[model samples]
Target: MARNRFDIDENLESPFDIKHFRRAMIYIRRQKKPMIVAFLLSALSAAIALSAPLILQHVVDVTIPEKAVGPLFGWSALMLATIVVSVVLATIRSRIMTRVGQDIIFEIRSDLFKHLQQLPFKYYDDRPQGKILIRVVNYVNSVSDVLSNGIINFILEMLNLIFIAAFMFAVDVRLSLITLAGLPVFLGIMLMIKTRQRRAWQAVSNKSSNLNAYLQESISGIGVTQIFSREKRNEGIFTRLAANFRKEWMRALRFNALIPFSVDNLATIVSALIFLVGLLALGPGEATFGVILAMSSYAARFWQPILNLSNLYNSFINAVAYLERIFETLDEPVTVSDVPNAKELPPVKGHVRFDDVTFAYDPGHNILEHLSFDVKAGESIALVGPTGAGKTTVVNLISRFYNLTGGQILVDGHDISQMTLKSLRSQMGIMLQDSFIFSGTIMDNIRYGRLDATEEEVIAAAKTVCADEFIREFEQGYQTEVNERGSKLSQGQRQLISFARTLLADPRILILDEATSSIDAKTERLLQQGLNELLKGRTSFIIAHRLSTVKNCDRIMYVSDKGIAESGSHDELIARRGLYYRLYTAQKMEA
Candidate 1:
């Protein structure tokens, strides 16, 4: 066998820098009409607030002399209308913003979950499960919060700023300019806060992941802690991690909270400055009492948006960091997908060949090297080896669960990688060392072997594997609930159910990896009989931790610490009196 070679790409990068900002804007654009109306309503509300003094001026300086009630009633009605419109628009704006935030967050969560499942096995091996979960959660919440509030608040503030400036200029341009000039100083303070906040947020994220990892590992390994009597030690470590997380969270909140308060106070001080300037500019008869009152209101309004923009700036930076995290997950390149022009596997005659196969999970170690082997139609082979002798690795390559690093695995003489992954695996049956049963009825687990299999077919498959005997003893027989991962069943029974599942599929090739390692001698004997019947006309690979399980295979390969040290039939291999004979003698001696 020749070593199969292909390129590996390791430079992971985020999909795009701007994915989060665009997601936020999509909502704004979707509700553009309603948002525009809300902006106008907010603007009108500010305008009406400014108009109060103008109306007072008219009543005192012009209307009262005319003794007219008409102007007062008309101005009062206009003010009331603007207030009502603003309230309605504000309500609509809140509802739309909430909808946008939830929808975008939902999209992110769904895609992230799908990506996590699609990632190759090696990815999971390298990353902590708890940390990965925390990243997903933190990114979703941070992005959603910043996006929803930032867009609506920033837009409304800008509109409010525009109206207030217009009103102030109409009444007293000089005072308005003096008040507005002070805003740049507030912006400078916000910029400094933003810089600190970014570092604080990063610390928050790091600590959150660490805390979650600690909690998850402790809970999952509580059995080990109990056995070792290390419960107190584990709890103390967890408490310390949680405390550190709290410290990081508070530090971030302190910075996050300080930016807004400082901006608000600056806006207030600028308003006071405007009041001082207004007093001097509006000396006797130059401006009415009404004009001075209205100028002050406009001056205060002008500073509000500056404060808002400052808050929005801080939010935007944090949201962008979260967006970057989200895009990073989505952007991970799928390494083991089918070739662009891959075709479906044709009907099989059950022949498998490993031609010059060498593989390594990492660049540093070659787990399989030049392992050339063949399985002809209707032949059964056993793989016997100590841990890491590549028993499972050879079978994994044939199943195409992981692409080869340096070899060609063929099914019916066609390169397995050139076939669609679905097509290649559909023709094979696998019973792993650790079986998984979804939460469903016993019949459903068996039916998973072939979705379209009939009820009678399911029963037949179960009977063939000798599972029907105990299955019928259950309260509901085949319909009995398996519970999650078949926890409701005994280990031997779970093994029996998996056997029935594989039988129901009628696969052309079967790979059993330590399939009966957990069953007692009586159950193992029954399973062995059932397996011989099951493999009658198929090419099969069987891995057994116990040598007794390999007695009937036509050819058995003794995979030793070095490599294949011996290969022959049960009788012939025993005659050789080599590694296989010694292992057989040891098992008998123990028994």
Candidate 2:
């Protein structure tokens, strides 16, 4: 089956749906007070701008002709005040909208991060981390302008257009018609541009996601590239991905460039038509100099909004493409969640039972079939198997990492599925082969096992795992910072730190999946002494390739062909001369 990425469908009938646009507006709606203030300020600014032409007309037709100095002075001062008010209002509106836009971006990013935390492991397994990062960082930023400037400006320009047209028609109906004759042509051009630009911007978004994914993968595996001498080959792959991104970016830029050029030419044509009609159609005194000047101003104002809308349309298309990608991720259903009536498990006694359990990571391919096993309280069981024999799968099932497809797993006589995952996993500790060490001071990484652990307790846990001796050798001792993935530390040292962390948790049940594989023989012997004390009263399952590790367990199960083929202690298994005996002999011969 194909993995679900929750990607947007590029074949949607429209470039953008009203429903998606409305959903984006919900973030804007949250800042209702600031939005209201912005709207009012925008209206006031438009009104002030519209009054300029009327004042000019009055000065030319009445005030200047009358030659009354006092009245002329009053009108000039009034026009200057209007200009000052318009500038102030525009500045205030911009500030308010900018704040609102940032707030929306913050909320969306926070919510997306929180949602990702709630999603099941399967969700992340199917999607790339870089793609998820793009949604949180890049895509959210792309829509910032739409919320900050696009919506408000679109509304303001439409209102300006309506008011200007009303004033123009009220002054002279014939001239107003002549001024607007080019509007249909402008609309047709914008419609054509919108369709083509939407697809181009969508391509740009896809290419960006691809480039980010490839870059993240390459950087994370840089060690592999250097070890295998693949630097030149990997560079070729990165170059191709980057080239694809640039190609789509240029396609979108072409449409953006054409929009302004078309609007500018159309504006010029409309102005010329309005001038000719006013001159030829009107006789002397019928069209006064003041009236003609006012009409000319109205004609210019009319096309200005058209130009603004066309530019806004370009931005809207780009923003919507990113918005769709973000929303698609947000809308994915969380598949693994606690049932409504789930209850916390009581204090665990470390007794586990897997009754006829069958499991698979994907459908139709079973890893464990009818697997029944039981471990009494405080028992130590070791699982030994070949590479695909499902030894780790059994440990994962015990911790409920993945739900079983058939039968039941029980912890202390209670069905694990009926218990809250937190309650079940908190009492269990797992230490895997490649133990991940987060970047922080050694003390902090150990404290992650138990957040509220005291400094004294942390030191004691390190000593229990024989890690304190080596830890204190460093200049900073326990205060030493581990670089990303603990790269500064050796593999053996990393395992010792992880051992200290798990020991601090003090779980009732423990799982060690090849936990000692990286440790040198001398350190492994030291670690074994500490392990003996830690495992005394806990139910533990150890999966190890080293036959020596399993020799001391109460019982060893050799897993094969999707089930346990034999179970016995080391001496008994050796006497029986079964699979375990052959494996031990082969290992001894190799050594």
Worst 10 residues of 1 by lDDT: 1-10
Scored against the true structure, residue 79 in model 1 reaches a CA lDDT of 69
Evaluated at residue 149, the lDDT of candidate 1 is: 56
Overall lDDT per candidate, in order of appearance: 0.75, 0.87
Candidate 2: residue 69 Cα off by (Å)? 5.4
| Per-residue lDDT over 1-591 for candidate 2, one digit per residue giving the tens place of the 0 to 100 score | 232232322332334578888888888889889988998998999998899999999999998989989999999999999999999999999899889889999998998999988787667776667777888999999898887778888998999999999999988888888888887887787777777888899989887887887777788889999999999998898898888889999989999988788878877777777677667667675677788889989988998898888889888989988988878878777755567899999989999998999998889989999999888999999999799899999998887777788999998999988888889889998999888999999999889979999999999998988899999999999999999789989988999899889889999999999999998998888889889989999999999999987799988999999989989889999999999999999999999
Error of 1 at 562 (Å): 6.7
* Alpha-carbon lDDT of model 1: 0.75
TM-score of every model versus the real structure:
0.87, 0.92
Candidate 1 per-residue lDDT, tens place, 47-131, comes to: 5555655665566667677877888688678767766766675677567667766766776788789998778766666665676
Off by over 4 Å in 2: 1-18, 65-73
Q: What is the lDDT for 292 in model 2?
A: 80
| Residue clash pairs of candidate 2 | none
Model 2 scores a C-alpha lDDT of 0.87
Best by lDDT: 2
